[model samples]
Target: MRIRHPGALWRGAQAAALAAAVCIGGFGTSGEARAEYADVVINNYSDAAGMRPVIFPHWFHRIRFRCKVCHADLGFQFKAGGNEINMVKIIDGQFCGACHNGDIAWSVENCNLCHSGKPGTPTQVHESTIQKLAIQPQAGGQQ
Candidate 1:
């Protein structure tokens, strides 16, 4: 090809580099580009049904909506493992289904998105609220 527009080739290369960076950076080792461990793991009925535990990203949801959205409006209990969440309830527009029913968010059809945790994991809070709020030790043992 004739070297008519040399600058065009540089622009194309830059565009390619940017695209590659975005594609690679958009994903993490796990599925989403967020924390390594989920905020909450719901394994109440997953093990019995031969399915992976449900990894709920509380942090992700908290950033988008207030606590009342799920706690009060959705009737989800404040304590972990308190609410009896299941596929039936979710599909019937209860609990998670209230929002994840293809209207507000993704429906139950996307199983792996929620149940992406390792097998045999128990239902509990992955991260502790106290730990997050606790003051960390300063460098060199200084408070």
Candidate 2:
């Protein structure tokens, strides 16, 4: 057999690693893109005191409900910080409680589902989500 160039081997290895990352899903998925999910992030935003309220990752809700379910019925306000949602109201069947009374999205036992605000932390399942999206096919056929 002929000897192979070291540079070529490295390049091939790099490409394989990238493909594996994309495939094995430490990066993102290919299905979630078109899956029609909602992000809790600032499709809407408001200033408070000084800092931003919090970014809501819509993808978080995608696995749970449809857009109308929360935006129209639950009164999620469509935009971040737009709806009058909070822990107290959620517990009382006002905002999140519109369904979360153990019948939908999850139960009150999973309070941080909305309050955690961030993704992929101990509280929120956002990081795993990022990987899920990475592997998912892009929405509308665009990369």
Candidate 3:
């Protein structure tokens, strides 16, 4: 039997687990692989500031980094719409700025990169059934 390095084995296991997660997460209820759009819409102040809401592509980040990187290390709240993310906080290297400060990722100066959501959209988690359920019916019994 050949001796395998412990670090190499750990890294291989990590890579395999990541691959499995990606493969499983990419499928839908119909068992077919589906594409995911921008996951979160951050419109806390974009509309008031005369800019489009930010479309945060969570899948893009999730595939590259583990959940703890943002949730635990960066102190991001796990629940949607829970974190009070703002430009002032970001520019101060608090949240997204930690990585998007022109080194690890694109700088905040590239407005269109993140602020590419549609006009008049509120901050929310996209593709959620909760949003569909929250829609009230019309006065005439129309959905």
Candidate 4:
């Protein structure tokens, strides 16, 4: 049957053409263009301590562990600042403490490792990576 709304068909064609042009140039759908591992900065709850925000680099962690190790086993919320981690919880062997204890990567005593004394570091990384990703195309069709 012939479609009655010709404008709808024209709009759909225009959208498809735009999407094709975008894909041909390298950027996929918005989801594909986004970074696979983004750095999460936890500062909303830590600013009171006068400490810099913790910049958790997902790319670094992804190198050694699977996503399930933290997302599923440790129960970390996927959203940034969603877990509400703090020093007390870390000392109690919760959240980051689950792995950062002396027996593992590094003890909480080494504060400078996570807290770089500069809140802007993580923000800069995130912004730069995002800008780069927007311009550069990924190696494969996948993210």
Candidate 5:
């Protein structure tokens, strides 16, 4: 019999949890893996400010970033409206500010970046594309 390191076990568990969250909650099962959502609206505080709901284009982000980058590393929840992001936390470099710090991507000061109530104008990625990208690797091909 062989003993496994505790740290290795912990990492394995975390990876499993992340995989479950992605497949079950976020992306759904293989058969049901279609378009979960085209965009996410951030209205946690928009109404209070009398502003339009911020439309987050899922397709736009998915194209450039891996799901793990935002979902696991940045701590964004799997479901829409799951992450309670606010302006204060953002300015403090918490949620959106994590990358939109005027360095990694764009400055949060660029209000139009997120505040656009309309769908993003960037290239749209279909659900099939996403599903293929996420599942192909597990099926023995590149992700």
Candidate 6:
């Protein structure tokens, strides 16, 4: 069922595809990248040393805690590594201990979850690997 003005149809499809891509990337233009976790290093740090990487996922906690939960109640230091915390502080009510203490994510029993803060850590690592290994069709079998 070939139609005339094929170019117009192609353009329409291209426009639709682009719109879809933008929607996915922007997540409805919330003005932030919607990922499981975002590696954000707070700055104005000297030599990036003060700039410790922070992992934030809007979806994960948004379902449970409000913005004020971490931003205010937790008093998350906005500056890079500004508020260095340890287990002692957490057990007494500070940083992640504010909620992650089993009441929220999983308490002291799950200490290693957030504190370790491993850069290579992945909440779920399968999807990206599969995409990278995807097979692509070649121009010619004997090329």
Candidate 6, 1-143: lDDT as tens digits: 35469897898887666676656553232222233443332222222333223344446677787878787877885543466655577788788678767776677665334433333222221223222233322312322
Q: Model 1 Cα displacement at 11 (Å)?
A: 68
**For each candidate, how many residue pairs have backbone atoms clashing (under 3 Å)?**
0, 21, 0, 0, 0, 3
Model 3 lDDT tens row, 14-115: 767656655765423421212255488777778789998888888899899998999899998866657888888889998898899999999999999999
Pick by TM-score: 1 or 2, better one: 1
Misplaced by over 4 Å in model 2 are: 1-38, 41-56, 117-143
Candidate 2 C-alpha RMSD relative to the actual structure: 13.8
Whole-model Cα lDDT of every candidate shown, in order: 0.71, 0.50, 0.72, 0.66, 0.63, 0.48
Residue-wise C-alpha lDDT for candidate 5, range 41-62, written one tens digit per residue: 5566665576655767777888
Task: Give me the displacement of residue 84 in model 1, in angstroms.
Answer: 0.7
Clashing residue pairs, backbone N/CA/C < 3 A, model 6: 101-107, 102-106, 102-107
Give the TM-scores of the predictions, in the order they appear: 0.63, 0.39, 0.67, 0.59, 0.55, 0.41
Candidate 2 displacement at residue 18 in angstroms: 33
Candidate 2 per-residue lDDT, tens place, 1-143, comes to 23389887888887777777767655444333332333333212222322233345566656677888866776665443466555577688887677668776476675344443322211112334444534332322443
Best by lDDT: 3
Candidate 3 pairs with clashing backbones: none
RMSD of 6: 13.5
- Weakest ten-residue segment in model 5 by summed lDDT: 118-127
